[model samples]
Target: MTQLTTDAARAVPTLSDEQWRGLLEVRATDPGAVARAYAARRRPDPLLSRKESLFLVAADHPARGALTASGDAMAMADRRSLLARMIAALENPEVDGILGSPDVVEELLLLGALEGKVVIGSMNRGGLDGATWTMDDRFTGYDADSISESGLEGGKMLLRIDDRDPSTAGTIEACAQAVTDLAERGLMAMVEPLPYHREDDGRLTLLKDSRSLARAITIASALGTTSSHTWLKMPACDDPDTVYASTTLPCVVLGGVPGPDPAADLHSWGRALVQPTVRGLVIGRALLYPPDGDVRSAVAAAAAVMRAAHPGAPAA
Candidate 1:
């Protein structure tokens, strides 16, 4: 047996041969943790064991004023209701993890639901949605040490670059420093990069040009002291082929706002998720505050899409 399979076999000694095969099948779909999986198989580390083909529902809406579900505005404004719904979702067997602002995360922490869970802290909320400073992202979430102390799994940040805007420069520099800081502490930093361009009329648009997207990827991938723990949170570019070739870093496609047909959005996501470097997804409004009212159903549907893309992949 290969080192990975051997390690996996030893880790779950209680499993029969059939169960071990099933576990190996699950690990095949997760490109992001393949190495870790291999190591786990050889000498299963408690920290590295993961489920398969899962996604983290983003509940960072309150920070961005996107507090609605299925077009119902401010649906997430009620802290108790939101927390109840989130806890309910987390309790679901299908749902794997959570992505939210520091405040929301702390709430989860207080509820004691974060233990053994994949808790990803949102690192930017200063660029509130539709605000004038939306593009100038800020690090408002848990820092490296804070994440470690909290017993959280990882951290995430937004890096929207509108070259014409001076604030983007600050965000870039701060992001680089954040990456270095997170890496030094042996934590994962998921960096979402967007090459945004503000028109003379102040309308913000993504620069879909291959060169610009590639450049943005290069800059993002090269940030921090060590790129080993860095993962790129990217949008599915107009030319996915070019975007796929832009960087060697592992990536996850981000889910934008909900569209008229949520299933179609997931279908598109399924395609993006299949890319070799695209490890998984960091879906938000599309899954949590879906146009549909059922959070459980919506989350299941999203998980189904992820599974379809890479059946039996290790869960996030």
Candidate 2:
């Protein structure tokens, strides 16, 4: 087996027949390559620079059966394309790390793209999008022990609370346990709490109002035995000030389904970034599959917004 290097210049290449074949060869012959790569990975130390913020690229949506981006329903259905886009986005120096499920994280580890990057493990992915039981999110992906053993920096769990659904209680309980477990291991516990209401047709619809989101934030912040190492991942809402006032825990904005206008989305994120508690961004589809299909440009534009929002601040 060929050993992978950590040189950023030669880390990841365009998805091609040769690249695919190589990855398959390793998986077929030496299934332990994934573990080997992870064990030998050059991890990023000190996670963040002095007072610098986080900028993680999220790719855990597909694991939850949510792949639409900018109106393209199956835009991320192709694994090769998705990995290629992730590589392109991570190639930029501004990107501090990645947040993904076990499979995606291991693949990037084998590709040597995660070297010197803050790797965040996605914990709950059993709640498939558009499913009848979407509120019963389970810890089906990486757990705190696995995250620690794999040299990951943090664990992220999705908490969707539906007022009308009883399954939401199970999700809340599981998220609280995950937070406690990760915190006990001295790893960052990132919680994404979103409020939802069931419609007459039985579909769950997210409530973006400041009050609802603010309530969700308070609930998530109080989870676990302690909030010492917990972080919040939230949407860049219209009333960021009011919504963010719920907690002092560090917060990162998630770029939900991109709107028709990309500039408007960036503007909204810029406004949210100015909030003292809003640390940075953990965007996915919007940056990975932009309307113009330029992954590099989209990522650069987002980094520019973060830089502008914190002028004179050192890069994380």
Candidate 3:
């Protein structure tokens, strides 16, 4: 049997070298052997490691009725295939972390993956697109305790405030409580805020003005118990300068739907990636399951943008 080294033991603090070695020694054991050994001896740490900064690909759209890829509708409708492709992409060396709905989290957990990986649970799915309840985002993912129990690092939620829509107030209050809960549990909460309005035709749309975006961010940043664990996931406004003024909290760009030219999309993403306060991207259908059906290539392209923006930067 291969013996575990001291450094290896330190790297995986949940298990001592001798215990890890013992587990490895039982090679002919049943399929549940490793799991039983892990359960018996390991206590996984449910904290985010500071070694790396991550480009968290968001594949949580299905829960929100966003199943399109580029121009193709129903792109993410297939759950099993999507999970397989996501696992493959995550296996890539350059890939770092994930941001997805609770269903996605359950899928990853059942696959016996996510160990030593940054797992961010999607906390909102009630605000389905085109629904009357779109403005009232609700927490539907892992709570602080569930996140800790599942060994997940953190969770994320969306906040789209449409002043014309009274539901926005409910979302605001819910978000405040959620943030307080996450902070008290020492879990990170990534919040994406949008100041939007429903047009006469009832199509929800974001205001193009920077002032609205800034105000929205400020309103979101002020929510929750502590601002320390909150990250603002904002969209890059028409004027890049406005992005810098939006919020003081650590921010990340939310990848919009992919365009006709993926290369151009990558370039635009690269530009957003270069923003000073922009930590990284929380990309969804754009990167995970592209219209092209090449998850590896799409993820690589996005990873390239991240690498170009912050060369040799560590994953978060």
Candidate 4:
């Protein structure tokens, strides 16, 4: 399967004020258009590029009240700007798909930006960003039936495990069930598992040690009745080789909080992409709200890394 070429990859695209207003108007009066738009949208074929991997743009942060990016507390608060940035990334042919909540995905569908692009519906966004019950992540987004009915390629869920937080057990159980549900439908179930520990100041911190990550990977890998259609979304780490060795399930590197250097981010993802279990990238703020505020350039940079990284053999 040849990748989408430059000639096929479109130039920089636009989302004018008029089109923005039209979306608002439809939202105000005709809500059913959302469903119709999704049903009518054309789906992608041979979803992955020739590399047998994906480069998905993620926009599921806002749905969970995580509006901060690149030092701006309200960076992703503006829907119009967010949608425009997503379009900028999608126009580049190297971008294979997107992992977003229902609202963002529907907006892209209505805007006609998602045609022929893989779409992964975001699930389990009920845990508000900073709430005390953050560990009680609930499935407030697309379910398996809805994802399949919506013609999406798959559904994604976040799993945060904390020893002190008993709520983690519930979240784990829910994700396991979701994994089973998606597999039953013969659809992809993307599970992002991360270990967490609360600080004395009560800050929920992600545990980034290789051991912690490896443990999380094993747990997520074993979820559901079947692992046949499961994919793990892993955070960039210093020891991907050691961490990824914990599971045979296919994995995609996710861009966590953006750092000051985008090159560093790319280096990490590029390294992981070469790993047999690591398939591709599902990046969000790092590309959408890049330090330089150039979405296309950021996307192109990641795409360049994908081409240079030499992905491992096709995933089993």
Candidate 5:
């Protein structure tokens, strides 16, 4: 594993060769250490930062075979590079938490890098990126029970509703059950309800129009037996005011695939953050593997965006 470094010395902690070897040794001989590490991990009292907003670094894409970043087809395929980028992003104090799958979270726990962080386990990654059975997104990752048992603060699931596909119904049912289960445990269930349009080629395209997104948000807000523990993860749509008006649930904007221009993405995020119900940003690729390839700079710039937004929202 290459040592992860940043141009700014204070941005990311220096990782040494010994630490990498230690992680390997534990994986090879002491698999149970992951559980102990989870128990030992220190969690943030309030999931949101002092800005009263949640800025989570999303590291769960790889589990779903969604690894493209910018122009790179396999930008997140290298685990070491991915973990290094994530560690760099988390070093920024403005980042409130992380939403990751079990493998990635366990690795970070073992690295002693997840202390004082709000860890939300990612669930339902069975719908691989390019698979034909994508809409039937199954719970192949963390369940509500495992998330609670692992001492995580929350659990996140992707709910993609494709009107043309019958599998979407089953996914909605599963997500509803998950929401209820998490609520029973008093854990946050972050639901990312996305609307999709499928073409004859079987390719799924996301529908980010205000009407589509608003409907999706409303549907997601009504999931499970109760909405007490539900928080919606939505796209920073062109008409965020209209899209966000569909539900009163606390929302967080998600960073989609990295576009050609980072500034353009930032501008859209700015617009979305102004919505009264939108809380913060849950981004991954745009910051971790930016066009400039500077993780620290990307993270700092994103933090500046959050601080510049309405920083007086309710925390936790």
Candidate 6:
């Protein structure tokens, strides 16, 4: 296996070679260490502060075969590199938490990096990117029971609605059940819903129109028996106010694939954060691997946006 290491002088404490070897030894022998770590993990005070805004770094895309960054197709293919970047991003105190798959979350937990952080488990990744069955986004990751057992703050699932794809129904049903299960445990159920259309070339195209996005919001909001504990992870669309107004459920804007201009992207997110219903940000690659390759700077800039949106919120 590849060994992981990071500069000790760096702000983030990357997994040293010794730590990596130790983790491997534990997994090789004491496989129960992960659960034990979770059981003994320390937690933060309140999940949400008075202002209710948050900033969760996302590191779950790689499990879905979506790893492109800065036009590099294989930028995230290296596990060590990905984890190192995540650690660096989390080093910024402004970063409230992370949204990651079970594997990533466990690794962070084992490293004690998740201490006092809001950890949200990713619940689905069966719909691999560029695959023929991409519309069938099954719940192949963290389930509600496991998330609850691990004491995570919430569970996240991807919901893609394709009018022409029958698999969409199965995903919807699964997500609804997950929502109910999580809610019953008094945990948050974050659903990311997108309207999709498959082209003749078998490529899935997301509908970015405000109406289509709003329709997706309505569908996701109505899932499960109740919406009291549900949160929407929505895109920062052109008309975020109009799209977000479709549902009363609190929302966190998703930082979609990064563009060439970081300022413009943050500007869009800032605009979306202005919406009363849009609580904060759940972003990934954009902030983790910015054009300038400074995770702290990127995260701080993003936190500034959140602060501006919730002027009365306590500082991070």
Better of 4 and 6 by lDDT: 4
Local accuracy of candidate 5 as per-residue lDDT tens digits, 77-169:
978778888888888877887899999999889988899998999999999988878788999999999999999999999999999999999
lDDT of 6 at 53: 76
lDDT of 2 by residue, 182-272 (tens): 9999999999999998889897778999999999999999999999999999998889989988899999999988887889999999989
lDDT of 4 by residue, 1-316 (tens): 1133454334323479898999999999999999999889889877667678889999999999999987878978988989998998998988998999999999988888999899999999999998888788999999999999999999999999999888899999999999999999989999999999888887888988899999999999999889999999999899988999999998999999988889999998898888888878999999988765677989999988877776353421
**Candidate 5: segments with Cα more than 4 A from true spot:** 1-15, 311-316
Root-mean-square deviation of every model? 13.3, 5.7, 10.2, 5.7, 3.2, 3.5
TM-scores for all candidates: the values are 0.78, 0.94, 0.81, 0.93, 0.93, 0.93
Deviation from native of the Cα of residue 251 in model 1, angstroms = 1.1
Report lDDT (CA) for all predictions.
0.69, 0.88, 0.70, 0.89, 0.87, 0.86
Error of 4 at 309 (Å): 1.2
What TM-score should be assigned to candidate 5?
Answer: 0.93
Candidate 1 per-residue C-alpha lDDT over 78-136 given as tens digits, one digit per residue, 9 for 90 to 100: 66656656765676655556888876765555454555557777777788777887877
* Model 2: CA > 4 A from native: 1-13
What is residue 89's positional error in candidate 3, in angstroms?
2.0
- Stretches > 4 Å off in candidate 3: 1-52, 312-316
For TM-score, candidate 1 versus 3, the one ahead is 3
Per-residue lDDT of candidate 6, residues 194-298 (tens digit): 998888877778898998999999999999998889999998889876898898889999998998899998999999999988888999989877766667788
Worst 10 residues of 2 by lDDT: 1-10
Off by over 4 Å in 6: 1-14
Over 121-231, each residue of candidate 3 has an lDDT whose tens digit, in order, gives 888788887787777787776677776665566778889889888888999998888888888888788888888878888888777477888888889899987888898
